[model samples]
Target: MTRRTENLAGRALMAAFCLAVLVPFAGIVLAALHPPGSVVPGLSWPQHPTLESFTRAWSDAGFGGLLRNSAVIALGVVPLALVCASLAGYAFATMTFRGRKVLFGFLMLGLALPYEAAVVPLYYDLRAIGLTDTPLALILALTGLFMPFGAFWMREQFLALPKEMTEAASIDGAGSWTVLWRVLLPCSRPALITLGLLYFLWAWNQFLLSLILIQNPAGRTAPAGLGFFVGAHNIDVPLLSAATLIVIGPVVAVYLFFQRHFIAGMLAGAVKG
Candidate 1:
């Protein structure tokens, strides 16, 4: 086959893959729109579709408080993670220092270790410090947990930059901090935004950490709160579906808004790193 034919075939396959993924989600939307307590076949559009299920789910599930708590955690995590990760990543990628490789190896070890494996020890440690059940605990724990990936991502972005750029900036009397903030970071927008959005989604949807770390129901994230909501309303499909959408809406919206940047960042990181 010609190269043109092969390219067309690849595009067709990708379209089919996207359709396969979206069909199930479309069904969930339809399920949420169906009348409460009514059985609807898979992917069937409801004759009397209404958004009443959304309202009911939002109010009944205490999603207002849950959402607030999630927002707090995400807001705390994203900026802190971004700043720390970018700095660390830039150091690892650009600077030569004693024990740099050893330190980076330790950071990479975090990527290998499952967060679940350390949860028990973390619990006891936090309990000892009297940090249990506080938003601070969640923020600190998640920031640590997300550090490995965030640092690695920013490191890759920095590595992809031309060495001459930094050299020229230095010759022009710009310090490392000035070069990073004024020169490199402005150009690293795609990677930065991608990292921030990923952190937001992970922090928002965090279930086990939210469930175990926060003793108060109001401090739980949406996914963790949805676990409790499911226990009581699992049989109510419409309500469950609506709650799922509510829990996922912000993540989906953020992804849609940054779709192009996210794709570009991922591809750039993969190719250049």
Candidate 2:
């Protein structure tokens, strides 16, 4: 095929994919706009669109508390995971240590372990320590769960940097900490931002961990809270859709805000790899 024909075909394919995703989302939005207690048939537009469902769902679901808990867990997990990942990545990439390969392989095993398989034992373990039903439980669990991917991501990023950067910093009286903080981190901003965003997204959307660990209704994350909300109002499509939008709003906002950086980081990794 000619280049122009290939370009048109690709554009048409992309448009189709976009429509596939957007149509359902549009249906949800339209459903949420219908008057409360009224049945929405498929993707039809409401004659009287109202924000009442959004307000009602917000109040009923206690989204304020749920979102706050999610934020707290995400805030806690992101920093702890980032620090550990960065340190581990640096050590694995730049420093020599005994059992390094063995340890890394062991750590990578976490990537293979399904979250569903581990969550049951993890809940029991946390309950044994009386940490269940607390924000700290989710925070710690998510941090540990995220480490393998975070470490691997940062390791690849650090490895992609020229060795001379570290050597040059060392010759200038820079220690390991200094080299990492001053020289490497400045250059790895894209990768770090990308990894942090991923951590935030995972921590925010974490339902199973929050549900299994946090028995207290007040301490549940947004997604976990949404699950119960769904149970209570399964037939209320408008209310459920509004709550769903609320739960996903922050994630969408964060991604839109950092969209450029996220894309850049992915492209950088692709080129490096």
Candidate 3:
């Protein structure tokens, strides 16, 4: 195909995919604006839209507390996961020690083991330690579950760095830790930002682990509280829609800001590996 043909095809494909993704979000936005008793309603470019539901969901649902809990968990999880993963990843990539291969292999296996599989055991463990129903407990679980993916990806990123820089640093008598912190890490900013975003989104939206580890409604993340928004036999569709949009809005904004880097980060050096 010609260059123009390839470019045209790519633009069309991306436009189609963008529309596919946005349609549902458009539906939610419209639904949130629609009155409680509207009929034949399904996102028809509302003639009369309002923020009435969003304001009510926040005011009535005690969304303030839920937002606080979610924020605390996300804050703790992101830094903890990043620091731990960077340390482990740097060790795997730059250090030559006994059993390093075996240890790194085990870390990779964490990615395969479904986290839901061990929720029961985790509950017992946390309960034994008296950490259940606490934000700390949820943070620990998010960090433990999320650290592995970051470690594996970061190790690959560090390994893919120019060896000559490390050699140069070592020739100048810099230690391994110094070389990692001052040299390679400074150069891996994109990978770090990308990984941080992933951790934040996952930890922010995490429900299953939060449900098992945190028993209190106040301790639960916003996504989990959506379940309690309605009775068993009745549904509060507008409030639920508003809550859904609120919970997701921050993460969506984060993605929109870093979207240019997302595709590049995801596909970075994939074919070579």
Candidate 4:
């Protein structure tokens, strides 16, 4: 097709794609505010909207504790994952040693082994280590679970760097660690931020691991706590919806603020790979 025709088609396709993605979120927002009886009565716009549901979801449902737990888990997971990914990525990209391919292949395998398979082993391991029902346990598990993808993605970014840059730094008598921190990382901001954001979203949404590891309500993350909010005794649909939206609010805000950065980083990493 001609360039103009291709451009027109692409724009049309993207507009449709945007509508497809946004319509569901709009529905959720509407439902969050609609009257209590309206969820199944029929879809309609919210009128005489009130945030009482949001307030109750925040306070009465004990969502505050869950929110705090999620924040702590994410805070801990992000830093630890960044450290592990950075080191592993630099090693895979720049350092050459025996069994390097074999080791990296093992790491790649982690990406495929679904965590459900490991939950039993992890539970036993946590029990053995006396970490069950603890925020630390959740943080540790999340860090380990995400490491493989984080390292793999970061390795692509590091490898895409021109070797000439590192070589020049070395010629100036800089050590490998120094060169990596000072020269390579400054150029890889997009990759680091992209990975951080992805890791945050994953840790935030993880319910299975949290559900299995955290039996205590105080330690439960937001998603699992939402499950508790909808119970046989009381199913407050509007409040639940409001709480769910609040749980996802931060990630959505981050995406909106960094949409361009996110797209650029993801495309650059993919193209380089």
Q: Please, what is the TM-score per model? A: 0.95, 0.97, 0.92, 0.93
| Higher-scoring candidate on lDDT, 1 or 2 | 2
- Mind giving the per-residue lDDT tens digits that candidate 3 earns over 1-273? 999999999999999999999998888887777654344266676677777778877776677888788888999998899999899899888888999999888988888999889899999999999999999888898889987898888898998888999999999999978998999888777788889889989988888888788888778787766556544213556666777788888789888899877656666647323
Error (Å) of candidate 4 at residue 104 is 0.4
lDDT of 4 by residue, 54-136 (tens): 77678866877788888889888999999899999999999999999999999999999888999989999998989999989
Candidates sorted by TM-score, descending order?
Answer: 2, 1, 4, 3
Evaluate residue 213 in candidate 4 and report its C-alpha lDDT on the 0 to 100 scale.
Answer: 95
The lDDT-based order of candidates, best leading, equals 2, 1, 4, 3
* Worst-scoring 10-residue span by lDDT in model 3: 226-235
RMSD of each: 1.4, 1.1, 2.1, 1.8
Q: How accurate is candidate 4 locally (lDDT)?
A: 0.85
lDDT per residue as tens, model 1, 24-132:
8998899999877788788888999999899999999899999888888899999999998999999998899999999998998999988999888888999999998
Query: How many residue pairs clash in model 4?
Result: 0
Q: By summed lDDT, which 10 consecutive residues of candidate 4 come out lowest? A: 34-43
Best by TM-score: 2
Candidate 2: where is the Cα deviation over 4 Å?
none
Each prediction's whole-model lDDT (CA): 0.90, 0.93, 0.82, 0.85
Q: Once model 4 is optimally superposed onto the true structure by TM-score, how far is the C-alpha of residue 115 displaced, in angstroms?
A: 1.2
| Sequence-dependent TM-score of model 4 | 0.93
